[model samples]
Target: MATAWFPLWLTLKVALLATLGSGVVGILLALLIARSRLWLRDGLDGVIMLPMVLPPTVLGYYLIVVVGRNGMLGRWLYERFGVSLIFTWQGAVLAASIVSLPLIYKAARAAFEEVDPSLENAARLLGSGEAAVFLRVTLPLALRGIGAGLMLSFARAMGEFGATLMIAGNLPGRTQTLSIAIYDAVQAGDDHRAGLLSLLMSAVCITLLFLSGRLLRARHRA
Candidate 1:
């Protein structure tokens, strides 16, 4: 039924957006970590990677407390700009991004690290600016890894449930992403709907996994 699949559709939409946004942020963070000679690089590296070490549910709860309209950052946003995030699609995306950030960070960091430092140094010696060297030399060599990171991040975001539910709630047309929809169907004893959503999510996740694997293998060949 249309009603049954509505939640599934909403979830997929939110997850897709979250994946893109998170992928971009993660790659940027990875690049910063990779290239940084800053005084606190070690400390900053730990901070960026800390989310992966924390429990996801706890992180989600923290997100709600920070980004929810009634929460600190959320309240500030509302007071300053009349913006709200709690119980919305954007909130779901934020939750998913936070939950899956580790995947992107790890993938991109590894990719960036794999580039030979000498190539970048040579470009710099040849009078290329730092930005120019990164764009023309480092990024090209790391493109395959970046692609793999994107696929991994996308798959992880697609499976995000706890954090997204906590921040976004389970509003059918607004925040009922595929994972939450499946959970709701099971709770309501609607095995049929539950099974369908499960299969759909599974298929999507599998496809992403396959793509990531392929990209990683190709990188190995290169």
Candidate 2:
């Protein structure tokens, strides 16, 4: 039987987009929180990490409340812009991005915190602006950690099923992802397809984890 490659392609596409989106947002938020006062930082950090600890179904429900057809934001978008995220590929991306954010944020924040303050201070003394200092000094030093975070987030996004299914529904060739496809295959008694997809997903996740470990080791060596 010819393997259905669409789920794999869709999974990669969603994971890639989610990783990019979460990476940018996560880094910025991590930096901001790291520099914030204790109270504000704690509050924001807890809020940002809520999705990580919450049950996936619970998070998906909240997402639905916020973006479902009759939902607050969803209603406005649908009426004004004719945009419907629910039951769409974009919704899957959104779900994946949300769930992957905490991994990126935590890793990036830890990396940022480990950066030498003296280096930043020296750059400032040398007339480097905040942006310049971050670009030239801080970011470079933390690149490895950030890269690891991106990979981890990609892995998480690729495996996201509950939230994506809740919002995007399992529409083959549209919103059905690898994880979803695997589940569908099993339900339909297509064990062979499910096993193949499961193996592929495992391989991808393991490869990402291996790369992340290498990046961490390299950072330590540096």
Best by lDDT: 2
For TM-score, the strongest prediction is: 2
Mind giving the per-residue lDDT tens digits that candidate 2 earns over 162-217? 99999999998899999999999999999999999998888878887887798778
- lDDT tens string, model 1, 1-222? 677567656766776887788788889988888878888988877877776787777888899788777889999999999888888888888887877777888888898999999998999999999889989999888888788767767777777888777778888877888888889889999999899888887787787678778877877787
Q: TM-score of model 1 relative to the true fold?
A: 0.88
Question: Clashes in model 1: which pairs?
Answer: 11-177
- lDDT accuracy of residue 38 in candidate 2: 66
Q: How many backbone clashes does candidate 1 have?
A: 1
For residue 140, model 1's alpha carbon misses the true position, in angstroms, by: 1.1
Off by over 4 Å in 1: 125-127, 211-222
